[model samples]
Target: MASENDYINYEMQKRTEPLLGVVIHNDASELNANEWREVLINAPEERYVQGIAHYYIDRNGQWQAIDTENIAWHTANQIGNEQYLGYEVLESLSSTDEEFLLNEQETFRVIASDMIDYNLEPNRDTVKLHLEFSETECPHRSFEIHTNWKTTVDGIPDEWVINDLKDYFISQIKQYMLN
Candidate 1:
């Protein structure tokens, strides 16, 4: 297994584009965070793209890894790779359990935090799925999971659904701060 220290020193190239927004992804691996880190350390250059997400949310809704400033190699087809921040919520074997819901909430919280930190808008245009840039089904499972949660949850206005799920999550963050 790669030590925590080994995963900290990635020599990412400086980004040419100004930070625009956030892109969410699912790692699609069965490995947990530590195992994923070890695989990333040992994987070939071609596999580095999988390791490109700036942040990774573990199964427990905890922030396992973060690299906010440096540009990661997450998005493919050269889309949004440099222009947006990226996060990967581990979904190798995720299910719609309480743990997954908590993890999803943490994912939203981190995205909200990044939105504040980067001065970006908190809407569909800014907070996006990897599929928006690529043809892949990345984060589709997670997205569907959250979409269902929205329909079932109370207090979230129906109008919020048209705006985008990020808006709902942002509202949740606001509510969390108030309480």
Candidate 2:
């Protein structure tokens, strides 16, 4: 009852709306491309959750991208899921800060290239974080590595919000675009 091209069909999860922005997330685990591909296909347990991770940087510091034409069920919100590509940066399994930062930098470079292809600019509107769409701590490692903010009494961040993260990522994307 299913085929490999089932999701590839335009009627399935294809992107209908014009390309808008990008949502950055941290996978929180280290999985290879084949492992990630399997996760993407079988991880759609939640209702209508596509479970697709559109972009990421492998542990080898290589940028990887999935089906960009299809709408990734990444963002919990429909708007983001339909309009933007969700990028997942592989987290450091050994908790190495430098390795994680390097992974993020590779991701940023790929994202910057995608922005150029989509004719998008590095700004608040075009750059987004997973926390903005839902209450998840996605992009967590990225936030922690880039900023000194830690969880507060609310069990979430206080001083640093999505804007701070967005600004930092936007600046990074901009820097990559210059190279």
Candidate 3:
């Protein structure tokens, strides 16, 4: 059987388009290709050496699909993640239960294939995790990746959290400081 890493690489090598960059989150916010497989069954049928940079949601309550183009609030680096594509894996209250979605994994494979088909370069180098960029333990619980997700640099908020704590904090701080 084809391994997950192999599937990911194959998808990446296929993308020929030049893209902004790839954004990864330590939270369950990123989407793996396996979950996407449900939407596009034929993804496995295609052969790709690389994968696409996209976003996804966790299985906490219901599976919500995140937009790849829209910027997220997950800031690992200090800079704003305005140009990078974001991908989030799902996380639950339980660390042991945070299983990687097979569809998300498959979706990742197809995305990599799409990028290769378009002839583009991924955001930066590889996928990134929330904590890798900064000091916060985001993606919460068991949402952390074991590999390349560690590319996050220190003091880089280029990739920030979206519509979550980041926003909440900005709102709360603004309100509290104003009094």
Encode model 2's per-residue lDDT on 1-179: one tens digit a residue.
Answer: 11122231222367889988899988867774445545554333462354555765654643233477777778888888889888877754544888777767877888998898999998998888887777777777766667655433234565346678788889999999999
Model 2 stretches with alpha carbons more than 4 Å out: 1-12, 32-34, 41-50, 59-65, 151-154
Q: State which candidate has the highest lDDT.
A: 2
Ranking by TM-score: 2, 1, 3
Prediction 3 TM-score vs. true: 0.38
**Predicted structure 1, TM vs. truth:** 0.73
Give the worst 10-residue stretch by lDDT in candidate 2: 1-10
Better of 1 and 2 by lDDT: 2
How many clashes does each candidate structure show, in the order listed? 1, 0, 75
Please write out the lDDT profile of model 1 over residues 69-162, one tens digit for every residue.
6667777746488878887777536555565566566676767776777777665677766766766656644545666533223322243443
* Selected candidate, larger TM-score, 1 vs 2: 2
Report the poorest 10 consecutive residues by lDDT, candidate 3: 6-15
Question: For candidate 3, lDDT tens digit of each residue in 29-124?
Answer: 333334543443234324211222244433332222334333433453433244445555443332343254433343344445434554444333
- Higher-ranked by TM-score: 1 or 3: 1
With a 3 Å backbone cut-off (N, CA, C), the pairs that clash in candidate 2 are none
Q: Report lDDT (Cα) of residue 18, candidate 2.
A: 95
lDDT of 3 at 16: 29
